[model samples]
Target chain A: MNSQQIHLASRPTGMPSQANFKTVDVTLPALQEGEVLVKNTWMSVDPYMRGRMIVSDSYIPPFQIDEVLEGGAIGEVIESMNAQFPVGAKVSNISGWRTTFISDGSDLTLLPAVGLPDQHFLGVIGMPGLTGWVGLFKVAQLKPTDTVFVSAASGAVGSVVCQIAKLHGCKVIGSVGSDEKADMVKAMGVDAVINYKKVDDLTQALRDAAPEGIDVYFENVGGAHLEAALNVMNPYGRIPVCGMIADYNAETPQPGPSNLLLINTKKLTLQGYIVMDYWDQYGEFVEQMGQWLKEGKVTSEETVYHGLDQAVDAFIGLFEGKNKGKMLVKI
Target chain B: MNSQQIHLASRPTGMPSQANFKTVDVTLPALQEGEVLVKNTWMSVDPYMRGRMIVSDSYIPPFQIDEVLEGGAIGEVIESMNAQFPVGAKVSNISGWRTTFISDGSDLTLLPAVGLPDQHFLGVIGMPGLTGWVGLFKVAQLKPTDTVFVSAASGAVGSVVCQIAKLHGCKVIGSVGSDEKADMVKAMGVDAVINYKKVDDLTQALRDAAPEGIDVYFENVGGAHLEAALNVMNPYGRIPVCGMIADYNAETPQPGPSNLLLINTKKLTLQGYIVMDYWDQYGEFVEQMGQWLKEGKVTSEETVYHGLDQAVDAFIGLFEGKNKGKMLVKI
Candidate 1:
């Protein structure tokens, strides 16, 4: 069988371009005795992928030049020798940016037989979903009375944070790049939405939006968003830093918040976390999130590219804020 | 009876001068029933006092202009009508920058008779001591295997933190301004001492000091110190921010660490804390610290300025790094 794969052609200096990635056609290897063949149906392109494109040590290894890129992907076992993952079983794995691959079944997880669509498994109930859950409930320790502020409010993890904070009876303020994004976040029950692109001063806008000051800041965009949040954060505020999409493409390290002294004066706690560390609680997360989806308490949104050729575009589009929510590539 | 008090003449814009304070003589009021008269022997001049000089809401109320300034002080009760505090009882209170005062005995704490000097209660065995203990054990959750980095390692709190981490079997790296200060910190069993003033690149100096990377960064100075620490911090590192003495005197807000994004990449936790919030644990701290002092496991250092006239100088000297350890005024 033939498979299409996206390989890292070169490391990007600043904002990644199409030249940084290349699509290649390759013949798939026959599945070994304990292995299964997965035909990837949907692949996710997250902002965090930018971190892997750089030549540095991080939570995950950097993408190697001239090698296939990896990320969250939903697949179906079309041919399998492993009893644990029989033929026709739907699965999720980190073998994304590819149309098909043979896996040893250890890295693949059988998708639960939920009523949600297959694409939802690559978004709302997937890695992004777990990120929002852990960052809010575990890292930030969200309180019912908390006034939560979410940056990148229309993005996958951020949208989840906004809705989750609202469902927990907390007041939420969201920051988005455009009017459309603002409207989308506002529809998710965000008490105030800051169209950051239209604002002259983000700090002033955040201060006006969160008059009582934010108790929890779900940090997705760093740079100005972090600076603005620091300005209006209440004493003892908590910041769960999930990603800094703003600085992801910067050639040079950006200057941090000037008001960082507020961290001390305000007694703030800023914690950084990666989702994989909390995978032990994935079962518990699926149970609750699955229930939320079934009851219409939570919903999923996607901006999907159709082929492997557009996968690179979908990933680069994340930095440009072209996607409404989860950016995915459908094979 | 007469008392000499140090009053705030005006709010300082940048680094404070003697002109910002005024020493005035006043007749002591007659002590009412249940009140006690205290003659302050030693008063502490802390870097955190600079925060109070600014007219802003903080953990503690801003020092009011044209009013008596307040801070940590050690005093002996010369006269008492309150049964809880008798004459000759040594006490500690926030009635400093003054020679004498009449209190209702509400804010005073009776000093433990551990055979240490009366001024030791103003430094190592006082609030600064408690700050080091709480920041290390409570906030940073220090481990014996941890490689600890302490900024301003010759200052009151930093010195104690260095000693405590050393006693706990942790490899300690210390940053100090002068060779003398570096030697002082080195004498406290710091594994590596970096004279930050001598280093052209603080980040490189820190990296060279702790090639293994620091697990716990005891932040006393911000600005370059914070930036350097971020560069050298290991994955899952913890920062317990006690003070930012370097930025305390800046008229304009300083830019934070340019590498603040490392907080996310390294899964670091930076927590800001005030010593007052952990006062409930003061008894436990005193018991442990008192034992350390008695057994010679701990020692105190002071840079004393005699008389209330020199109180303002002592306070101003803190920003200039004039004090070897605790800056104190003996009245």
Candidate 2:
């Protein structure tokens, strides 16, 4: 039997291209006593992975040259030797960018069947969902009456952030790159949606949207979005920095918010966090998100590509703001 | 009786000049019921006052044009109509930039002798002392094993911050503008001192001083010093912002740290706070700091100006880095 895998051929200098990755076919050996041969179904492509592609020390190690690039993936056990990993069982794992793989079962998490689609475990019920929840309730400490401004509010993590803030009875304002994304985020019940592409000054747009000033800012896109948030933040405003996808591929360091002194004048707090740091909250997150799904209180969406060959484009599409929600590759 | 007061004559474009203030002699009215006459002894000149000099809404109201400028002041009650404030009793009040004043006794806090010099209450046992304590244990959440970096370490608040962190058994690194200030901070038991004036690259200097990453950064001077702290901060570090004296006089906005994306990569928390917000903890701070002062565990210092005529010069001297510790005008 054979499996196909994507390897990081070289590190990128600026925006990454298909030339940075190489695909290879590998002949699978017989599984060892504790190993399970699993076939991957869906793989996630995220902005944080862009950080991992560079050759430097970051929160996580950079992807090595000619090694299989890894990320969130859903798979089904086709052959198993361990009692815990029965054949036909579906699982969520991190050994992505491959169509099939043999796992020792340590890195795999069994996904319980709740009648929702299995690929959702890669998005709304998984990392992106958890990121939104933690960034809102824990990091930003969102209050019931807090006026929240979420950048990239139509994307996976941000979409959930908007919905969760709304569920908490917060007044939500969102910013998106296009009118189509604006419509989608508005459907999620945001109080106002600004199409940043059409706006001359994001700071003025935020002021127009939130006349009373925002109490919490969920920062995803960093550059001007962060500047806009700072301009209209109320006293004691909280900013939970989840990602800076806007500057992830910049050849030079982007200038930070010039109004950062307002951090002292307004007594603001800006905290940066990665979702992996909050794994201890996973079970609680899954339960609450599952209940929200069951009650139809929240909606999940994805932009999907059909095969592993489209993985590179799917990842690149994220930087171009082409994805409506979670960008995934269906293998 | 006549009282001399310094009023804000005009707002400054960049650095304030003596021409921006006007001194006036006015005959004070007889004390009303429950009023007292406070003869000012020592008045504090702080960096935060620079923010108030600008005509804009901040955490506190901006100093109004042609209004008497007021801040932390220590005075002796000369005549009292209130039984709680007897004559000859020292108190800490906010009716500063003046030699004497008639007060309603509501704004006065009676000072206890505590066997120490009375002016110590204005620095180590007063607002600046309370600021250092609150910033260390409350805002930054400093641990005993933590490594701390203090900017403007020879100034009023940063001096106490260095001493308190040292008493708590933490490795402390301090930055000052000159070797004289560096020696003063070193006497406070800091593990290392970086004379920023002598260093070509402050970031490299900080890296050399704190070979291991710093756990907390007490921010007072917020330009290159902040940039250096961000570069050497450990993962999950805390920054309690107190002031940005470095840019307080800029006519145009100064760009913030360009490498601020490290806030996300390092999972850093930058919090801005003012001492006024933490007044509820004053009793605890005074009690602990009082004991430390008595036991010789901590020492207090001040640079004094002789009279009301030098008040403007004393305030302006702060920007020139003329003072070693608390900068006060002995009126």
Candidate 3:
């Protein structure tokens, strides 16, 4: 049987439209001696993927025209000839967006939640959770009493960052797109949530939310939000940038931070984190995270889209702030 | 005996004028218990003092109008009742531009130099030296083989930063205001020196200077200098801020870095340092610095003014880039 896949038909000038992708079927060779066949069950939609799509030498490869649109995905071992992953076993792999895939199993790792739903592999227990945990602990290196300000706080990573900071005894503050997500973030016991869209004075809202001054900023949404954070950031504040969601859609970069001199005056540290480079420490992260999970110290929310065809819509919703939490497509 | 001292007569609008200082002689009383009278020998003129002259609340209080401007200085104890620092002993103290001083000897630390020029204590062996060492190793934590970029590369702190970084097996780049200072920096083993004044493109000059990318930045001058460094800074680059000489004389606070979003994109770490705040580590620093000096790993230079009368001239020359190395008033 031929394998069904989605290909990149055109390079996106701004946002990736339906015209950017083309669905087609291609014949696949039989599994090699060490290869395993995976039937993709779920896929992830992330803002960073847009960076990879651009023809720049970023953290990941650029998508070529008329090629399979590929990224992190969860799949089951439908046909495995290797002892590592037997046939009919459940697994998650980076087979991109494909109905079935043959794998040598070298880069493929087993997901811990074997009994859980396949969508969870694309949500809390997967890459988003890892990104949040690693970026918060490694990049931010938060202190317990730190007053944190998180941009895009209702999203998967921001939501996890708040919960994790709360677990670390931090006073958490979040900036969300709408009053509803702000309320949702507030309901999670985040000390404060700013509806950035409603706030006329961005700096004042941040200062009001974090009265003591922001010590740690989990920065994802950039542009005006970062400027506002710069104003309210305390001396020696650290900003761990997981994504610049606000700048991703811009055809050209915005005139970058008009107030960056604050970095010297306030002594701020801004770090952009891409979690894939940190997989070596994943075992240690999962161990601590598993404990946080069991003790109820950390919790997560999701925005799941049913059917593989909805991947584009789910990914597009990220820029529009339609997703409540982790934006995932269940294949 | 009456002691002559220069006081800050008025708050400066931009570059300070002669009217900004009030020179007066006051009769100093005899020393009391545990007190010693210090005769100012060599006085230090630093970039940070410009910041302190501004009326604002920061890590340290701003200089008040009609008060003597004080900073790190080296003096000789003329009379002492304190056993810690006896008479005829040289000490490093805060000697506000004055002929004599009354101190309790509690905060005073004896200078460490044997037949070495006493003024070197104000330059390499004094607070400026400590500032470079503390900001570089403790705050920035620069590693061996790191590529370093220094702004105001001929000033008291910046000059030494290049030498210290070189001693630590790092490739160093510097930007100076004058061709003579640039040559001096290059002679001191700095790999490259960008004459920012003549350079058509500050960013391109920085890139060409540091082809491998800048790993650490010793920031003595802010604004355009910082913008240039940001453009070519490596991911996770460390910026240790000692001063902002470029903006020190501005009538109004200048527009900050227009590209500070690079901090997030490059994952840079920028830290502001006040040398005295890290004084507890000075003993260890001085000990190591002494070895580096004795082994000829580091050299010293100074721009000395003959008398207290030239203090204003010396200070003003700093802004004009007239002085190379440490600008000091030999009292």
Candidate 4:
């Protein structure tokens, strides 16, 4: 069988473009014993993928030229030699940016039909959802009385963080790049939403919103957002750094927060984390997050593209803040 | 009775000079009920005091002009009306920079003679000791297999950190300002010492010393030292920020590490703490540290100034790296 896949054509120097990706057709071999064939339906595009595109050392390996780009995906089992994965069963896998793939079943996770859309397995009820849960509750050690400021609060991981903080009885302040994203996150129970693009002075805006001072800062966008958070943070404030989307494509290394010394003067803790570290608690998170979803206490939002060919565009759009929540490509 | 005291005559802009302090003789007031008179024997001078000299909000209140500067001190109670404190009892209090003081006995802590010199209470067994203990074990969550790096390794707190990490069977790398300080820290059993003054590239020097990368960074100095630590830190590294003495006297904000994005890529935790936060564990710490001293497992080093008149110079000398270990003035 033939399948359409996207490959890295070249390394990106700054903002990645369609020129960095090449779509190709590859023939799939017949499934051997214990192998399962998956027809991918939903593929994820995230900010961390930007790091993988660069030719440098990172937690994950860089995507090589003329090779299939990989990520989170939800697929249907079209054929299976393994008894555990029956034909027509739905599953989640990490062989994304492709229309169909043959896997040994080791990297695939069984996905039960939970009544929500299958794409939710690629978003709010999946890795992005877990990222928010662990970073806010465990890493930041969120308190019920904490006033939290979330940058890029309209994005995938950040939207879930906003809703979770609100549910914990925290005063939640969200910063989004547009009025549209501000309205979306506000609907998710964010107490105050700052349209960062509309603000002349972000620090002044944050000070006005959090008059008492922020106790926890969920850092998604770096650069100016980090500096603003440092300015308005209270003594002993905690910052759980999940991503730095603002500097992901910068041509040169960006200077850190000018007021970084405040981390000492204010006795703050700034910790960075990846969700893979908490994978052992994934089942526990799913139970609680699943309940919240059923109770309508949390909502999942996504911006979906129609075909595998649009995967590269979906990824590049993330840097431009083109998606409200999770950005996905349906194959 | 008349006693001599040093007061902050004015706030300093950059490096403080002798003009910033004023020496005055003040007459003691008549002791009231519950009041006790203390004759200070030794007073401590620390780098953090530089921040208190500036008129700004901090963990502690700013010192007012013409007021006696406060810090750790050991004294003998020459006269006491309170039954809990005997006339000849030794006490430790935060009423320093003066030869004698009158107290209500509320802020004073009774000191039992531990067989060590009285000045040891103002140093190795006091705040600086507790600072290293809590920063290494509590904040950094250090483990036996960890490789630790300490900046200002010859300073009061950094010396203790080096010894503690060595006792825990961890490899220790220390950065010192001069060959003399380097030899002093090396005598404390530091595995490797980087004489930063002699190095052209501090990061390369650290890389050579800790080829496997450092797991815990005892941050006593900021600026170049912090930048170097950031470069050679292993994944999941912890930085317990004790002090930033290098930037204590900067006239303008100093630029932070440009490669701070490594915090995210390496999943690092940088935590800032003050000893006051760990006061509850003081008794537990003193018990262990006392045992270590008796067994000759740990040692205290001091560079003493002869008179209370040298208090301001002792403090300013800290910025110039004038002391090898604890800098104290014997009144």
Quote the TM-score that chain A achieves in each candidate. Answer: 0.98, 0.99, 0.95, 0.99
Best by lDDT: 2
Q: Per-residue lDDT tens digits of candidate 3, residues B211-263? A: 88999988888888888888888887888877777777888657666566566
iRMS values for every prediction: 1.0, 1.0, 3.1, 1.2
- Can you write out model 1's per-residue Cα lDDT over A85-104, one digit (the tens) per residue? 99999999999999999999
For B19-74, candidate 2 gives per-residue lDDT tens digits of 99999998899998899999999999988899999877588889999889989999
**Model 4 clashing residue pairs (backbone):** none
What lDDT tens digits, residue by residue, belong to model 4 across residues B36-61? 99999999999989999997768899
The residue-by-residue lDDT of candidate 2 on A76-195, one tens digit each, is 999999889899989999989999999999999999667778888888989999999999998998899899999999999999999999999999999999999999999998899999
Tens digit of lDDT per residue, candidate 4, span A1-331? 8889999999999999999999999999999999989999999999999999987658899998899999999999999999888899889999999999998889989985567788988889899999999998999999999999999999999899999999999999999999999999989988899999999999999999999999999989888899999999999999998988878898987777667778888899999899988989888888888889989999998999889888888999999899999999988
Task: Please tell me which model should have the higher lDDT, number 1 or number 3.
Answer: 1
User: For candidate 4, what is the lDDT?
Assistant: 0.91
Docking class of 4: medium
Candidate 4: list runs displaced more than 4 Å.
none
Q: What is the C-alpha lDDT of each candidate?
A: 0.90, 0.91, 0.81, 0.91
Q: How accurate is candidate 2 locally (lDDT)?
A: 0.91
DockQ of 4: 0.67
Top candidate (DockQ): 1
